[model samples]
Target: MRHTEREPDYIIKNDNALINLENSVKSLCKHVMLRQENEHLKDLVIDRNKYETILGNSTPVMKVLRLIQKVEKSNIMVLVTGQSGTGKELVAKSIHYNSPRARKPFVTVNMGAIPEDLIESELFGHEKGAFTDARDRRIGKFEEANEGTIFLDEIGEMDLMLQTKLLRVLQEKEVTRIGSNKSIKLDVRVIAATNKNLAQEVKEGKFREDLFYRLQGFLIHLPPLFERGDDVVLLSKSFLTDFCKENRMGNITLSKEAVKFLMDYKWPGNVRELKAVIERAAIMSENLTIQPEDLIFANG
Candidate 1:
């Protein structure tokens, strides 16, 4: 039956070939145009105050800013410890963009998101035919980030076996693929972040002590939003302005009631949750200003 169908319907087959040729020509032209446009696209126009754009004059943010300044000139590994939404990644970006390697790639990997079975392969890559799914060779984050910096978020969530592999990479400055016998030298700097207490995890044997020490070359701790005082109101205003511009709404300011509510609320999700609350208010508010009723939190 399949062989009979393989004998092409002569009339329809010629028409199909002609149509495919025309489609191929059109696709080629479209691809060429896109390539030209991409080539003309200007390089990233990064704002100078990108970090400030996220966090305002809060003491917690100031502390992070100071740490970033102190460590930008060094190649030491940095460990940022904080709650989930406490802006650890922002600190990582600020350090990378302000550092000597700013021009190079800034790669981020969420260790907690990768599967336990593939974490090592995902970080160090695998050679072709290394395992069941290894149909093709892969270049891992460590390789992709060579000569640049790699941000490993939620490092505390990595499995004990992978922690040992990571420790080997840090110590040897090299990586060997899962199936490859040869080790490739690496010059990448690593920045790690986690919400868990590594000291406790070390005593529990969940994390390696040596890896924790290596990752803590320059340790930074970020305070939660509740402890940041007046920055709450300041950040609300900033987020309000940004939301207004993004949604093309007329400029709207926060009311006194709204400001007080923001200041009093205990932000469980930190600055991230704060930004979302303001954006929600900006979208849902019908009045010229964001009133306390317009804020969408349980307390607001």
Candidate 2:
């Protein structure tokens, strides 16, 4: 959770700690954590540095920040929806790092990347000899995140069978590892993110309606970078400055023409893409000044 997202290609890591602190503090007082140590948790999360890395003045961004403040304190399931590279995981990390569970393990599992047959074991662990490859007992992500938070990314890709098991686990607040009858209790906060339109997926029978509704205890939708107006300029300068300082390069500035060029293009890849382009431009430019000609989109 050092920077903007799970995507490390472009996220500057310096300010994310502050951002997490700021965003996480706003919500700690809003909800009573379902724990005996609510007061301790509050003390653990709140800090002096309040401003987090989320930089935007646009109404849409402001609304998202306000919602983060409202939802950060509770243990309710959170669903973050947006296009890929829109910083869904960033939002998820902001909540976890700024919450009472900041010191606990923050385990992340990418549902879409795991093979369907193995994901269940990856999430809930497996007893020794549970499967041919289960040579030893394994601790799953959920168990590892006990008393902390588990971020399930690309949840829309989880198959129906696993979805059923996951729903049961969420409902019971416990997990039974494969080949084991004993269920292990957990106190993990759940945060899930997806780029797919889950409503549409539920309609198509690809996603479970019950699970969809269950994940919607609090929903946050991240707008694509293109829709955030001048945040692009703010972000551009920030990234420019950080990249220069990080590399020990002399001060670098984006020419006015380069800024105009950034504002004009529709960033289909969102914040992640913008950061990559700027970092690349910073390196590819000949001098401290970055002009329009220095800009280059990686895939475009």
Best by lDDT: 2
Among residues 3 or more apart in sequence or in different chains, the pairs in candidate 2 whose N, CA or C atoms overlap within 3 Å are 19-52, 19-53
In candidate 1, what are the lDDT values of residues 67-101, reduced to their tens digit?
88899778999999988788898888878777777
Model 2, residue 42: C-alpha shift (Å): 16
Candidate 2, 14-81: lDDT as tens digits: 36866787778766645545453765764455332123467788888999988888878888899999
Runs in model 2 lying further than 4 Å from the true structure: 1-52
Error of 1 at 241 (Å): 0.3
> For every model in order, what is the number of clashing pairs?
0, 2
